[model samples]
Target chain A: MEKTILHLDMNSFFASVEQAANPNLLGKPIAVGGGIKKGSVVAACSIEAKAFGVKNAMSTWKARKLCPHLIVVIGDMTKYIYISKIITKMMVDYTDLVEVFSIDEAFMDITKTQDRFGGAIELAKDIKRRIKERFKLTCSIGIGPNKLIAKLAGELQKPDGLVVLREKDLPTKIKDVQVKELCGVGRKTEEYLRLLGVRTIGNLNSYPREKLVKSFGMAYGEQLWQMGQCHGASEVRPYFYETQAKSIGHSYTLPKLTSNTEEINGYLLRLSEQVGRRLRRENYKGNVVCASIGTGDDKTSSHQKKIKDFINDGYQIFKVAKSLLAITNKIRFVSVSVSGLLHQLDQISLFSHVENQKKVLAAVDKVNDRFGEFTIERAAIMSTGLQGKTGMVPPKLYGLRNFKMELRGIEPLTSRMQI
Target chain B: MVKVGTIIKVGVVFQGSKIIPRWFIWESRKYEVRSLDFTWEESQGLEKIIRFSVRDGINSYELAYNTIQMNWALENIC
Candidate 1:
């Protein structure tokens, strides 16, 4: 059977949520961003702000210059995640085949369930209506035979748009669209395509396959050909489907650029700990540790090394990352990540010290998992002033914690924030 | 906006699955909830919490209810 996929993309998600929560911001030009400091970029902008040529990912200063009256609100992950979860739940009510594309987007395989809800268009209308009524937010939904075309159709409209694109409609509906508009085609690829005189999707379709393969290699070239025909993967993996993570990493931008090794190491340790905590929580141990350092001049240096023994301890990860760190200029950003992951094999350690360290780490993980992240901290981090600065709590933690509470017939603390 | 992660007293009504905050006391002054702008739930360890973004007409405040403790706390003031 031909697949019927619906792609739902929230319009100006962060800014919309902010406006809904604070009525004062409604209909006003607003941009959701981090601290309005140097290098801070607008994460999302309201429709009012977009009218002034403000775009997402534009620097906050530049956005402010474009719309001087722009209300710059700090991005709040907790509220956004909450709203996203509710929206996801609503989608699941229609069909179990719901793939959360991002915090603000999802792809649903409504092939089976659409008929039950009168049809795909009816289901999409119901979803849009419910969202608007409940949260006062709007979303653009596109219906197509596959994910690629559905997403493309979604891009054709703006806030509260609903578009349907059948496979037969592809040639007439999107032949003139820019080739770069197809997902995954970056600026460099567009430039290369332009060199081949393939500027539109229609041009790409007519271009020789052998020539595309000769220029861009077999797999990518073939993928481009498929995209030109508006063909793509139709499988919508549900949210509950567990996929093994390829990497676990965290990075932090310092308040100010610094050349001090101690300060850099302090930030590195904090990042490693975060990465290590995530690794252990997911029951994965990795051999490769990657370190990235960003300089004040907008240059980044990244290095990764594989160790003999797989480890998930924060200090061990930090030691390996610190060795990889070789900085020359004043650094502003630091990152640590672990890759080459495998499910942690349960085995007794040969070294007595190593065994003790494992016990200590397990205990720390338990406490932090229950009370909050960084409930027990290292003496070194205390000196760094990053002791109590908690980041966003992962959704898995909330699910697990909520499950435990419900199982025990305990009243869940509604406002208990781990962040 | 002020982040006040302190405990405060509040009056609430549990209507079916909904939790409505009536009024809250912070620094010995009572502020009645004029409207609840938004509400959401969160969890920490084994504790589940419900948070409300409420306006008392003049200013907005974030109030949280800890069902396990059967208590209310003011989280933020805006």
Candidate 2:
């Protein structure tokens, strides 16, 4: 049976949310990003801003230079994540096979379920309308026989777009499209394909598979061949399946560059606490602890050490990370991470007193969870002015269970607003 | 842009669930909030701060409430 995959991508997600919340910014050029600080980068830009050559990841300084009137607003990631979750719940209502591609994009296998809603187009229209009515935001939806074609079709148009790429229409639809436009053909791959004189999907389709395999590896070459033929995996996994995290880490950029070792170590302790808390919360332990530092001149160095005992205690992780810091001058950024993760299991140990340590950490976590983070902190961290500082975590599409649980009891302020 | 860390008095209404700012008194003058544009939370060390992007007729202001300090500040105005 042929698969029917639908890709839904929110348009100008962060900026669109901002505009939706504020009517005055509807048609204005706005970019959602960091503070108005000098080196801040634009995380997302509105279509109106993009018209003036503004783009994501471009420095705010350069963006302002391009569009003098560009409104730069600091991003509210929690709100965006909240909205993303609500949208995901809506998608799950249509089909259980929903794969969240990103915070603003998802792929749903409505092949078997579309008939209930008349057809694929009808289902897409209904979902789009519901989102618009509820959040006052727009999204583009693409329907195809597989994930790749559906995603590419969705990217063909802009905000509030719907495109369908049937299997029979694949050759004509994608032949003229740039090979770079296909998913997985990034900058380096594009350059390599260009070297092979493969500029378009048609060109890639005509190229010899043997040559492709000889140039690239077997797996990637075959993947490219299939992509050129507009073929992709149709499986859409449920988000409830827990994907194992390879590593857990946290980092913080200092408000000011400092050479004081005590201050840097203080920051390291805080980061270790965050990483360790997350690891314990997720029921994972690791043997390797890594620490990294970024200097003012844009130089960064990192070191990792493997310990004999697997651990998830903050102080233990901090001790390892502090030893690895190497005491550098002019440090602007500090980070701590742990890898070599293993599922945590309760093991009876007489000498280690591990049970007592676990109990102490649990008590601390309970207090902090009820009140707020850093409510109870180490005495050493008290003077560093890093007690309640929250490091930025780039929003993830699937692993939002913890955040959702955190906000469960708190009434969302958006629900009470008149908008 | 104004300088950082300016404390101000803000009149807010607690509507059973969450706190909503209606107006703020900055520099001895009151600016009534026409609309609540956006709201988000931030943390400064152990202090959780709630920020609001609000409009007052002709201009927009960024106001924040520090839960630890139990005070409101006018963060910015544009």
Report the number of the highest-DockQ candidate: 1
Which ranges in model 2 have alpha carbons more than 4 Å from their true place?
Answer: A252-260, A293-302, A327-334, A391-419, B1-78
Clashing pairs in 1: A412-B48, A413-B48, A413-B49, A414-B48, A414-B49, A414-B50, A415-B49, A415-B50
Tens-place lDDT digits, model 2, residues A1-419: 88999999999999998887666788999999876676578999999999999999898899999999999977867668767877887887677777777778989999988998989999999999999987789999999999999999898887899999998888888898899888899999999999999999999888888888888899999899888878888888666556777888887666677889888888888878878888887898999999999988879999999999888998999999999877647878888989999986556668567778888899997777666666787787878876655544333211344543333433333344455
What 10-residue stretch in candidate 2 chain A is worst by lDDT? A391-400
* lDDT, candidate 1, A20-130, per-residue tens: 887768899999987578777798999999999999989889998999999888777667777887888788778777777777889999998799799999999999999
Q: lDDT score, residue A299, model 2?
A: 91
What overall lDDT, based on C-alpha atoms, would model 2 receive against the true structure?
Answer: 0.82
Q: What local lDDT score does residue A308 receive in model 2, on the 0 to 100 scale? A: 94
Question: Candidate 1 falls in which docking quality class?
Answer: medium
* Clashes (N, CA, C under 3 Å) per candidate: 8, 3
What overall lDDT goes with each candidate model? 0.83, 0.82
TM-scores for candidates 1 onward, in order: 0.92, 0.81
Tens digits of per-residue lDDT for model 2, B24-64 = 89878889999887676654435678877789977777788
